[model samples]
Target: MLFFSIYNQKGVPLLYYSLQHYLSLAGSLIFIPLVIVPAMGGTDGDTATVISTMLLISGITTILHSYFGTRLPLVQGSSFVYLAPVLVIMNSREYRNLAENKFKDIMKELQGAIIVGAIFQSVLGCSGLMSLLLRLINPIVVAPTIATVGLAFLSYGFPQASSCVEISIPQILLLLIFTLYLRGVSFSGHRIFQVYAVPLSVAVVWAYAFFLTDGGAYDYKGCNPDIPSSNILSDACREHAFTMKHCRTDASSAWRTAAWVRVPYPLQWGIPTFHLKTSIIMIIVSMIASVDSVGTYHSASLLVISRPPTPGIVSRGIAMEGFCSILAGLWGTGSGSTTLTENVHTIDITKVASRRAVELGALLLILFSFFGKVGALLASIPQALAVSVLCFIWALIVALGLSTLQYGQTSTFRNITIVGLSLFFSLSIPAYFQQYQPDSSFILPSYLVPYAAASNGPVHTGSKEVDFAINGLLSMNMVVAFSVAFILDNTVPGTRQERGVYVWSNVLDLVNDPTLVADFSLPRKVALFFGWAKCIGA
Candidate 1:
């Protein structure tokens, strides 16, 4: 059924398919900066710069993963798995009150934390610890842990989109229709509408929002159009001030202020400041990220190769992802890189699993990164419209997480109870910590208030560092859900079949079927170079 198989290298199909992948990934590629930069007190220029850097790192890492890692056709990018932890660090007590060089200082702290965590993750994988850890992970554990990642931000997604319903609602509706209803519609023998759903919806809604702004939809009679929202004195105008800011397509100056071209480099923000508390937080988050990637690796291999990869191959993929995250930390992309969960969905929909297409798409991402205006243009997307897309994305993540349970005994009482409890407590426990915030004066937007649990939560262990680390980890829904599920699934388990322990193809299988060796073994020259490492599943 595949239009292009894993090794297919037709030049024209490669080019067309690669472009399709890039367009599908564009919104999410630039999403992190739009969410985190403003919270860190960064400017539009900083947002655009981070977006560009992320694109560059994603491209490089995807290519690296294709060559040396699992060699799957999966793309690597900034993952939301790192987002909750980063937000926790950003909203910590000391940084909360900083008045000078806030953006640079925060970026440096995050960089240090990410580097330390990435190093730990690299050791965990390269040293073969992940293979041991895999024995404890099952679909029951993975299901709720991954789902909580998406559910953690329920407060933020739609509420932010509601800020400009006129634009955001239509955007959400259009995207749904394109991806669901009109998905069957095709052009020139290609499902162009379905393949380009995200960008097409954004373009249409963006133009409509532009017309609204140009036609004075939010103009106030007593307000000066040029004045900042904070400076507007009229009470009547103040009511509509937030609307104008979010609805107006010109609200951000990223495009006007950005340069024609710029290359991102290491330590562009400054030398990182290593702190024990933040580093500890990121280390734990990195483990969660690895757990997230494990499921993706299994599912993607099944979809592409009809067999699971050996544990050692999964380990190498995790290690390579950690190395890529190290690069992201050095360049300060503000989030770690991982095999995107969306990659599985993309392959399923596109029916193309060619490594050449992914590599070519990555090169296109790299080329786009060099254009400062490309990142700026993405940075300039209206906040509400962006939030609308995120709502759908987060929902999709939830669905995908649940879908993994299909590989297991989904109808079993044990699996259902474990998943339900993990998800319930993940939400319930975080709510308790977030509600315990003692400082009422610290006012953040409603959605961000959940992430502010690090500052004034009830965990008081005397040592500020200990308290910060504990409180921050507890506040993250993924960490809590993972701990619960890992414990329960390991201890109160039933049969291996009941637990749905993933059974990877073995060395004997590869030897019996020479074709699998071609599918998974290292390139011939590289395999010869690392013959001694065969015990590690290289």
Candidate 2:
């Protein structure tokens, strides 16, 4: 066995083991900011809460998943795939109303939605619903859904990059160079940099950004102690280092004056308030997250274990993700968890797939989260740096989406039509809604928003004004792409072999290997109760 294997004891040094854990933590730290969006005119404490909460949940979830869930080396963290919908719900008309709680009310409702939505996700995994769901999905549906996830978030990355182009552009270029070219290049034949590539590249770019922005003293008030404060809390004094100066002074002055070692517990924000419409939206996000996690499991298993994961582990991973998402809501992180692609890359680069190393990283993250200053320190990273990180990360995401095309017979017209139209409309509809809001009142209902034909089309124009209002939402790229791909793939008939259904179904059958399911399964009655013990394909 390799010295790094969790199942073996091959005598790796303690310091080396610790360094592995540190790299894993660094791999996940960048992801925290992706999930931590402050409210407009919001305070630094608010940002801190977001940062801290994400850290705590991610750390705990990683530990839990390593032990109780997949038992793989996957690191759990804030999911960008789930971000678009939560932002939509946060910006919804009904959610904006707050008597005094302001953004706290927003956090509460988000927490509530996540908690409730997670229940549905858990059911899908624990009750064998995922098996049923997969029977309906093929490469046509999978490719579009996965691809649209990256596409849907395109609006997120570019704007942030453009917001501070001078610093962002250089940062993006630097990060791309480091990860794409410098990656796996041996350092004195020791390969130190290869193992710590993500974090190290981030450190270099961040230092450069810090120098360029001069620690955000130009437009920031809090950075200069001589200047008076801005009353609004979440507002950053400086825009670099995640506006840490702003967070401490304006956002969470109370925290600045408060004690250290503030451990995060459940409901740190407040009781979650579920909204019927908003919860419905989050439920959809949850389902999308489920699919994304399943894909991550399969991909990670193939990379780490030289084969795809059996169906048992896939369902188990999904269930654990849902269960942990409920914890995220209780902890007030506002969104659920998904596997970090970066960490998987880290495993490949380092050639260390030990579960214990990941678990140790989780423990260290949990320890780091107690020092709220750590989150603040991370929060202070420049937006330019953030945009740079997003650019590199999103490129990988887009490539991952495209990778799904390999599963289908891409040369066939049927395959091309399914992939092309779904992808085309997915990008187009969301773009249309963003650019032009129709004035007609024939808009889609809250539940049917994801099912709308097209914003500009003549689906239902009885009330043109309503159509104008809802067009923007109904035309979300993911919703359109997934719905289109799903319907077409199912209704438009082709042979199982031609459609690649046979190959897909064959994967599901791998779950039927009694030894595969039994090898790491929970004891006796518990596994059966959760429906995780059965071989679905058999």
Candidate 3:
């Protein structure tokens, strides 16, 4: 039955080509732990167990979707972008201080929103709304947004890479040397040898840290003390500590610090609830997520497809993405989205675009997710080893961005301006937020009174309401500025001198063959002009 199901759908031979494709697809799995674990941090038994189980189920769903839905070879995993926001939310005192039952209630609410957003995505896909939206939003706008994301993330990468304490000057030199050695070996027809260098280097570093170094100082565990029992109950705890007794004997701690400290023998599951404030925040998150997903899909498609994807394919992919997120919410995991540039690079190198192969890879991921020991084992892998791997992954991510830029028509002044501005905003805003508001208690757009109240507790009080109102007014002003820019750019006629020879040629082309220029709508034309204006203005 399984064989027939696999063979009949694509009308391809099952054994011959399928196996090779599967292997190629499976190769991409090498990136999962390397990329995900560092950002996620080491999970103790409880969270680890829950996350692992969720991973397996999600992996299975992803595999099934790849096989039955799109048949595009794409590996699905926990998205990295959501990590920053989620960490902030989870760490918030407001989330933590809620009475034991109430905290769980809030979790349900947040999860519910995620599920709803995801389902909306799937609905958009089925109804072809996503495709319509894509067409309406000028690619020029998207190009700048996408370029901004890369530039923004580049700023993030520097801080993140620097945070890897194990990554010393010596370590970087070692990584460079090994990378070059692998390149040389590949040229000399020693492909197998080349393949081993990265993994081998990581293993060596880990072994050195474990045995030669003074008790693995490079690892997070080595530096931080065990979770305090009293601290667990302090309304600031976001993670539950796992001890030998908790995992092996299933003993409850005497202190009982956290409300959810005791592990239920049979896992408890619940539906998500909703809150108005959280919903508003989620809506913002969804918009950002949508932009990011679209950009990633376009970039990947440019690399893989000979022509632009059909609207149907794009919609289906978006719908599947939404479906995946809904499932993730249900399973008590963070949000999921399309794999970003790093994994895309992995796919390109592996040359495995077979959906079935990706499905098998998902199966592997699901298996890894279910077994608590597997996650624990991975966590056990020394920090030095993880850093060694990340050193390579981070470099690869930067390279992917640079490579994508090569596909642009020209690295012109307008392109540079867009890239510069986008990078600046993404990096600067986030940095300012982090530096000024380390407490995580404050609401965004810090000028409002209701926001001040919202920052204080779960329910909004008088002052908080006032803060919220003020913040809303300020936000409106910003929106108006953007609206003005949009309107003026579209309605204002260009001066005759401003319309150069190149502009005249384009105009002639549009007039000569209206059908050929049908897709170039007014908004898009205006956006192109604005890009030039920004370049000159800058």
Candidate 4:
């Protein structure tokens, strides 16, 4: 009996472990083409290669965290939201036309800022400040804000779906029909079909689109096989080093020239530098990242844990995100944050809560990060495949947001009003800003616009007004909206309830518990020490 008990405790069914590993890997891969490629664009083979290298690094780190750290079934990658802001800062007309030396200085400064912000996040996790912030921000407020993210992304999906050159009306319809058929069928056999239906759907779309184009002449050999250019690789490496001075003079010519310099394995770009601007940006990034993490944690806790996450667990997870961001900065990637929606999706699909699995995945990501060649190969995936994946993921995000509304109590006029207006302003204000922005030529020389214009060139080009519209709709500056929502949800005359939700109580409980104290890992203790030091200093 004793031996049996020990064996049962130590053993995991092989099939279960295998499925979990594959799911985690698939989740990581899906984000590469879906989120990363779309934001980065397709033309710059060098940029694509570098970004892929970064993703590979991030992937390996994720795998390591999964294997050796938390071991949760989660994967990490470049965040889509950060793309717009970083691009705005890096290639914006405000900065791009500056002298090479100035550009390098600014880039270094920004890197510094990011590092500082990451440190701040580490502190927040360690000191349990995140929990306090959560307490102050009511769920009513959080729900609508999160919902807006979904609503904002939802607008992009249809356009993206339609924009795929290969995905025609009939093909999409057929794919949808196939998806429905798969969904309708139930079996006791291997659940792989259900588990990977979305990816399968994407494959069908890609296959159909491939056949439709070039009369089946769209073979792999026919695709562009040249590697990215050395100059492009060098520039990307320099940028990662925070040395922007060496970027190509002619942006257009450079892109065209460096279209074939793809290195197959991960190459080390020099370490990142830190600066004030980067610090500020990192702060913002960390805050947004924390918000995203909170949302994901809450969602996952509700779905799987069936209770609010203990403070120690939450802190550890958040600290991991901060650590990942630091690693990201060191490795010359954008930023790293906990992706709640993605996490929730993984949890829902896999139904595995073992931290060990996530750690394994993180270990895998760490290994991949070193392989530039492998990164480049992954980057070579077709763009159409990416668009399809995002369409499905974004749709899931929307569904999750709607699910939160089910938790609300009173369907009061004030509640309805807050939700409505928050959604509207969050979507509208940014759109307006992007639409009326002066031409890049007006701000900088026409030659510099492609490389300089922060929003990727002119907003009002021809009949494609959707660019401006979508930009304005998806803007994230919803502070005012958040304020208004908070007032309506918590401070309105009749809105206050008998007992308010204390989001931080969970953290406080963990911190106060003597038994829980024993579970604190070495990293968590260090995080706490730094957090305390920062608080005292402040």
Candidate 5:
């Protein structure tokens, strides 16, 4: 085991880990500006202010997630799951055409939803009801449910890659080359090759941006001569006027207006508007985030400590995620925080699974976010490059989702169809909705109409509450896919082993978990006094 002053179990300082930490932190940090720039486009705040809020909330929550929450080394940072719904809430009819006030109100509604979701998650965690919520999920259900997370983001990811096709294509190529071919290779003298490959590849692309923009550190002339001195990306270097210059970097004249230090106060954007549709959507997304965190917790445990996560750990981790979500909502980030398997993937690349190193990295993320220049620097990144990086990130997530299928032991056609069909249709509904927004032709059956009415999905009777529910349910693509798979997977005849639930369901089996025995010892005693207590954390 490695040990150091910063760490006790591992004594020697592995500079590789320090570098790896920074790169991973930087990679996730870039997304803050990337996500914010789009929302704030043609609106308020500069790169520094937006990034500061993201870093502030993410950093604080990450610390809680690491030390107090799940106590896992997993980094709690930005998430894209809320991206769709947040945009939905922002564009809701209530706030439309409201001008400058629209931006503030939209942000408020988003924040309100986030806070509501957080409270729901906290109760799920602290009360131990989350386990019950996921008891029915198996690999087949999980397969498509998890896959949906990535599939859902394709719309957002593809647009970024398209912004500058030329810049993005090469970045995608390099990311694939590094992650696929070189992540495992090591030179005769160098052993940390796999670990170094990811960050090094990302560094190359980032540096490539500087050269592509103006050759070198504002040489004011890109290195490429043949591409065309007048090319949109290249000429930005020579003339200092980029076709997508702002997209490339966060440096804006507006950033100069940023205060040296910023403190993100609650309701800084505007008064939060509580809408049923948006709130429920965030709650569902937070639940999805919780489920994702379970996988991350399990993966982290297995990868680092060489074992599965105990029920107790899983419970606490989820509870912590809920608390962090509360923080995100209060901070008004328009989204909640969750653990990313990407951080665990980083450990695989580096071969250094040092918990202290990871925790320290989270701390650094919080601290550096205060420095306005850092956000400005990140802001300077080209949009195409950001999109290229997102493409790489989402591809990994897509693969991560697919990898869950291996545990299903999907040999029989019966099982294969379940997985395939779920994915196909899950993908279909979202694509259809994207292609054509909800229209009058898409009508629900009479029995289901009540739910649509309850959620106010399609048909509206002028009740905002009714309409909110309708919109929230329809917008949630994963719910449709998951319900289909869950119903089919459970009802279809397949032996427990064939379904992989024999092993996978152990994740849900609380009776045999010793840690859970101790955890519930006090609760069980308390349950004797109250019948509902049995269900609270049972």
Candidate 6:
């Protein structure tokens, strides 16, 4: 199904493939900033800045990963893996009632935590500790761990989208139609509609909603359009006020406020504030991100070159991700960069595994980041539409995560129980912790309620930092799932075949095979210079 193989450098085809990749990046990649920045009490302009910075960091990190890491065509960006912990950090007791400088304070905290976690990840990978851990990371551990990430957001998805059912419903329906029903309909030998499903669905439904807005569908006679929904004094307008914010095409002022051109630079938010509590939270999250990226790398390598990269290569990829995340931290993205799970699906759909094309697509992302309006325009997308897209996206993550079970014996009772228990406890244990010391006095948004336990959870270790770390980690679905699956899978007895062990290439075999060397080895000069460090994937 490959339209272009891994080494293909043909210009026009590469350009087309790159554009496809870029379009794919537009939806999920931009959604992170739109969700996170606002939740931190940031302005529309701040949201736009974060979006642009995410793009820039994504582009830079992906390019680094392709050439110097596993050498696969995986894209890197801000990920949902980091979303829960960031929310916990932002909603902690110390930050709950900040009257001023709220956004910058939270962002700087995130940056410091991300930097510490990134450094830890770098050491983990560069020291080759990751490869040793791979033996315990079979499909049994990965399937539920990754699935828990998607399931973690179940409360947030529909509740947010339902605010503007008119827009959100149509978006969901249109996207489903394009990706499912109309997928067979091709254009000029390409499945253009299916390949561009997210963007196309957004466009069609966005225009439809624009017409509804312009036609005064949500207009309230006495409501002040400039004020927030809570400020509406008229009872009649108060009910409709909420609708105006999400349904209106111009609800966000990002477009009006963002400059025409701007470039993102490191430390733009301010100097980060390092804290033991936040750093511990992110360090755990970084491990989950590494595991998530490992799944992506294994699958993408198969699509690109029909074999998984060697353990050393996987280690290199993780190291590169950590280094890239350091850059993301300095840039204050509020999230770390990692290999996107969507890359496997993108490669399967487009059949464009060419490294050159991926690099070109990354270059395009970098170029687009310089245009401040691009970020503003993306930020201006209606909240309902963004959530609608996320609903489908989170479902896709679940599907993809479970699909990894194909590598193992999915019919086995042991595998099934481990996965089921992990998932059930992942959600259930968090609920118990979250409800242990519930605060009835503070009113928070529906989406942020799950993370509210960060301020008043049951875990009291005397030391504030220890209590925070325990509470925060336990509250995260992915962390709990990963811990359970990893421990059970390692402790329980099962054959390699039954466990569905990942078949990573041996370092000796990798060094011996010329083809694999070509596919995954470091650049010639770098390899020669760092030959002494080969034990650690140098």
Best by TM-score: 6
TM-score of each: 0.92, 0.80, 0.62, 0.68, 0.81, 0.93
Model 6 alpha-carbon miss at residue 453, Å: 1.6
Higher-TM-score candidate of 5 and 6 = 6
Error of 3 at 282 (Å): 3.3
Evaluate model 5: give its TM-score: 0.81
**Model 1 lDDT per residue over 1-538, tens place:** 2335645456786798777777887656877788889889888889999999999999999999998788988899999899889888888767666577888999999999999999998887776677667767878888888898889889888998899999989999998999899999988767877778888998999999999989988777776544365437778878777877888888888999999899889999999989998999999999989988988898788888787876657778888888999999999999998888777777877788878888998998899889999889988888799889888888888888888887788888988888888999999999999996636545566678888888778899898888888888899899999998888888885887888877742233333455545565545324322322223445
How high a TM-score does candidate 1 get?
A: 0.92
Worst 10-residue lDDT window for candidate 2 reads: 444-453
Better of 1 and 2 by TM-score: 1
Clashing pairs in 6: none
lDDT of 5 at 327: 74
> In model 3, what is the error at residue 310, expressed in angstroms?
1.0
- Candidate 3: residue 420 Cα off by (Å): 2.1
Error of 1 at 430 (Å): 0.7
Ten-residue segment with the worst summed lDDT in candidate 3? 245-254
Candidate rank order under TM-score: 6, 1, 5, 2, 4, 3
Q: Give the poorly placed runs of model 5, Cα more than 4 Å off.
A: 1-6, 9-19, 25-27, 40-44, 95-98, 187-202, 215-242, 245-251, 435-464, 502-510, 513-538
CA lDDT scores, all candidates in order: 0.83, 0.63, 0.43, 0.48, 0.62, 0.84
lDDT of 3: 0.43
Count clashing residue pairs per candidate.
0, 32, 15, 62, 25, 0
Q: Please identify which of the two predictions, 4 or 5, would achieve the higher TM-score against the true structure.
A: 5
Model 2 Cα lDDT, one tens digit per residue, 407-496: 668788888899899999988877656543323324422322332322343335576544523453455676678788889988888767
